[model samples]
Target: MPAADLTRAALSAARVWLVGGGKMGGALLTGWLDHGVAPDNVTVIDPGLDQGPHGVRLAADPAAPLAEGPAPDVLLLAVKPQVMDSVLPAYRALGGGPTVVLSVAAGRLIAGFETAFGPGTPVVRSIPNTPAAVHRGMTVACANGHVTDTARATCEALLGAVGDIAWVTDEALIDAVTAVSGSGPAYVFWLTECMTQAGIDGGLPADLAARIARATVCGAGALMDASPEDPATLRRNVTSPNGTTAAALEVLMQESGGLGPLMSRAVAAATQRSQDLAG
Candidate 1:
């Protein structure tokens, strides 16, 4: 899409109300603000917001009617899964128009939204990681049948304000998305921790090992993003016959059950948990 088109699609009719202003909501709000979205067009409805963003109104309760503002063009539901029911009734009162509701709560489906907002309300379910705070997150979205092409575009634009957006036609894939990118950052952090411990075990000072491990992961990820080649090609380029990297790979990518299988199992377990939560 053209840059102007993308921007226009993203912010058009863009009066947005965020129902929760926790970490993920704050990340998205900051991103949108950084992208030149007028703070006046955004409202945060978090009771816990100690201080409001400049120019944006902060409300302690979204349960109350939208006090004199334009009906929201987009409603962002960012509360935890368990509290959606409690918080949804107030938002639902404003759903009779062309509003598109986008939710980031894990394990909730479009059907759950339909239950809350009545059928025919445009709903988009998304999974976004905490990395979004830095504008490097990956967000995956799925639209219910009620959502129009324009609504999808709008949703994409809103998510793109933070980082990348990928749409999935199959809603079932969203559980996998939750397992992967949604929960994947924690996994990567664990990997960093493990590598740092290994480095320390290999005789490096603890602080030095941690710093090296962190930088290595960040730098390698940046390099991978910059490179045109696939990761396998990149790995092959770094591995010499009988080299140290190759030796490590022998254990990580072993024949029977190695990192690949372990990761597959882990992702499957997470996907199953997401399904259970949705249930």
Candidate 2:
């Protein structure tokens, strides 16, 4: 099978109302605009945000209300999870219509959105990682049974603006998705930190070590992204007979307590945490 071309999807005609304008919201809005979505077609509702993408309207919250004016084709919820319960009800008025609510907020579930929007309403729960800011995000989304094919496609189009998207049929897998990709960036950053410190310990200057660590991680990631071969194949390609890379991999790939086992445990812990939060 071939990879789907998410960028080819259209959001040019959809009326979008974003309910938050913080980091993630800004990333999504910027990516959409960069992909040529009309500025006038988008509106942002965030009380704290005094500005947003050029030509996009910024509406104040609570008193001004999201339900006001014409309803949007998609109403995106990008607010903090802690405040979701307090803020979601207000957006309910915008639902039960043509609007398909798409949530990028971690830990918020589709059933919760359906409850707020009333039963049988289209809702999409997505977990988009921080790479979205760079327009290379990987988003995993799943929709409620109420969501039609058209609504799902619109959600995909809207999200695709930020980067690639993976549509899941089972919502249960979303917690794992969140743990893997949603929290994956932090793990990669931590790896960079560890590598940099190791280099400094090995007598390299602090500045040089840091730069090398950053570049190596980033360059390797770029290679992995562009390559058709799997990561294991790439790793093998870099390993020479009785080489330094092989020696390092010996320590890192040890069966019992190596990167593979440790990463499995780490992802499992993150996945469990996500499931707990969802519960």
Candidate 3:
């Protein structure tokens, strides 16, 4: 599929204040530029980080004050949740004024931002996985009632600049989202690890086992993406009656102690952790 231009003129026209310049923030800034948003329109406010993209402004904190210039239409909050209380209120001026605050800080509720940024601030809580760095990210977002239609669109555009996005009506669902896509990549990585180990146990050379496992996992994903049929159908197509693949499936598909139940319990635990973190 062709690259999406979800930002439209939203990014180009808005004055953006980015609070973090770490990996995820950097990836998003790069995404805005790649999507043709003018470099001059964005500003970075990470004190610990040095320079940002070529033409964008970078300073230890707000260059002047949050209210000083352009009245930033969007304030991208990509900082850690733990330090948010101390670092976030400083940006309240932006929030109190016009900027729609979009936060990727996991576990921080929209109400938390509302409290810090002051009541009535339009706040968006988002969860983006590690794949965001490669622009294949799966981001899920939910906004407070204060978020205007235009503000929501702009937030979507900014996030869509990096990768695909999905919005949920219920903020509670975010915990489940966190359990699934937010941590899903790590599960995939762990699968590769297990598969590689299994191959080694079967007497394959370590290096060759790693390569085969890696390729098989990635190739399967690619095929899934390209095909119209469901995953179950795809799996059936690769399995022959009483064949090697069937033999493997018999074990893997076992109801009582197989991958299915294991993954279910894993996701449940992760969801509970996410909820705890939110608390």
lDDT of 2 by residue, 230-255 (tens): 99999999999799999999999999
The 0-to-1 C-alpha lDDT of every candidate, in the order given, reads 0.88, 0.87, 0.87
Pairs of residues clashing in candidate 2 = none
Model 3 / residue 112 / CA error / Å:
0.5
Q: Give residue 92's error in model 3 in angstroms.
A: 1.5
Candidate 2 off by > 4 Å: 1-9, 62-68
lDDT score, candidate 3, position 23: 88
Which candidate should be chosen as best, given lDDT against the real structure?
Answer: 1
Q: Give lDDT tens digits, candidate 3, residues 1-279.
A: 223444677767767888889988988988888877788888888989776678998878775646468777888888888888888857766666568989998899988888888877888999998888988888999988888988887888888878889999999999999999999999999999999999999999999999999999999998998999999999999999999999998999899999999999999999999999999
Clashes of each: 0, 0, 0
Model 1 TM? 0.96
Q: Per-residue lDDT tens digits of candidate 1, residues 91-168?
A: 777765678999999999999888888867888999999899999999999988878877777777788888998989
TM-score computed on alpha carbons, candidate 3: 0.94
